[model samples]
Structure formats: structure tokens, C-alpha cells
Target: MTQHILGGCLCGAVRYRLTERPYNSGLCHCETCRRTGSAPALPWAGIACAAFAITQGAPVAYRSSARVVRSFCGTCGSPLTYFHADKPDKIDVMTCSLDDAEAFPPTEHVWVSEKLAWDVLGDGLPAYATGERET
Candidate 1:
């Protein structure tokens, strides 16, 4: 049996589970992610939309961009999931929100072109100027 990976919002108002192992775990330094998470970068783990489930309370959704929708807990304002219409089959869950965040460490850094000047990438992870793909 596959072990479920559980996570939730800070206040526990929103709970979610990943039915399968996540992939493409990375840190996103895009401006939108920085603004939404109020951090230099946002770490996320990607999984099939069918593999993710919101098992508890509903989260408030915000259309952060024309094709992007971000969800967060209304009670504690913790960012939860990010959905991009371009990749309808996949969704990214905030790694920091996971109950065992340390278990899903990021293997790469994305959107480095938008990374803050002061935010150093000393972790030695592969970094892409834009997305994960090489140009």
C-alpha cells in the first residue's frame, strides 16, 4: 500500500493528502510566488491532479494571474496549492506546508531570473533561469 503524505494549513482549517509520490520538487523564485508566500522563494512538489485531494475544509482561491490560481487558508492565510491552466494535469503543493517538509527537499531552483538579489543560491542545487527546462 502506498503511504499517503499529509499536509495542512497553519490553522488546520485546510487539509490535503498526496496519494502518490511527488515529483519535480523545486524552489520557485517567480515574483508571484514571492509575493504570495512573502518569502524569497516558494518550495513546491508537483503531483498529478488526480493524486491530490483536499480532505478537509475548503481554501479560498485567488486568481493571481490570467492562467494561475492560488489557494490559501482563509483562517490562517497559509498558502496551499498552485494551479496553472497550462498544466491542468499537474498541481504544486507548498512543501513548507507539508507535515514532514524535510522529507521532500527541493532538488532544483526555478525562475532564478526573478530571484531576489539578496537571496543566495548556495545550496548547490541546479538552477534554471526560467522554468526547469534548459533553454
Candidate 2:
């Protein structure tokens, strides 16, 4: 049996469902993620593009970088998903947006080179200084 995961934006303006389980669950401390989320790090799960679908309202997209696009709810400014043009097969969803976020714990830390000194999450998971571990 397939377990579907559901998530949405803060104001419920945008909703989504993952038809399959996510992988590469991790915390990203990259500068882009930090600035975009206004936080020290962002927790994300990788879902195949084909398995992800918008179930409700449309999300506004921002071209955060040449290779990446971030989507959010325009009304509530709640971050939703992250996509890389180079990797169209997968999309990263904010773990916090999930209906059962506690079920998806991060297994590693990525972009540790940009990690803030004060923001320490003592999970002792494998840390990647720059890029993520190849899945």
C-alpha cells in the first residue's frame, strides 16, 4: 500500500499531496535557503515530480536562483516547494508544511559550510559541507 503525504500553505490557500514516499530528507543551511525562509536552515524532503501534485490553490513562484525556483502561497507568504530546473525529476517540499511533519525526520545536514554558528541542531547526523549526498 502507498502512503500519501499531504501538506498546505499557512492560510490554506495552497494544498498538495505526495503520491509516494519522500526521500533524501535533510536540513539545508545554504545561504539561499536561509534567506528565502528567513531562518538558519530549512528542512526538506525529496519527492519525485510525478508524485507531487497541487491539490488546491496555485502557488506563486519565485526564481530564487538560475537553477532553482521556490513556490509559496501569495496570500500568506507561506513557502511551499522548491524546484531545480536542472533536475526536473524531483521537487523538494518544506517538511514543516506537511500535515504530519514529525513523521519525516531529517537524516542529514546539507550545505553545512554556510551553517550559522548559533543555530545548532544536535542531531549529529552526517554533515555535507557544500552539496547534498548523492541519492
Question: How large an RMSD does model 1 have?
Answer: 0.9
Where in model 1 is the C-alpha error above 4 Å? none
Q: 1-135, model 2: which lDDT tens digit per residue?
A: 377889998899899999988867998999999987889999899989999999999999999988999999999998889999889999999999999999789998999989999988688899888865655
What lDDT score is found at residue 69 in candidate 1?
97
N/CA/C clash count, model 2: 0
Model 1 TM-score is: 0.97
Cα RMSD to the true fold for all candidates: 0.9, 1.6
On the 0 to 100 scale, the lDDT of residue 64 in model 1 is 97
Per-candidate TM equals: 0.97, 0.94
Q: Give me the overall lDDT of model 2.
A: 0.91
**Weakest lDDT window of 10 consecutive positions for candidate 2:** 126-135
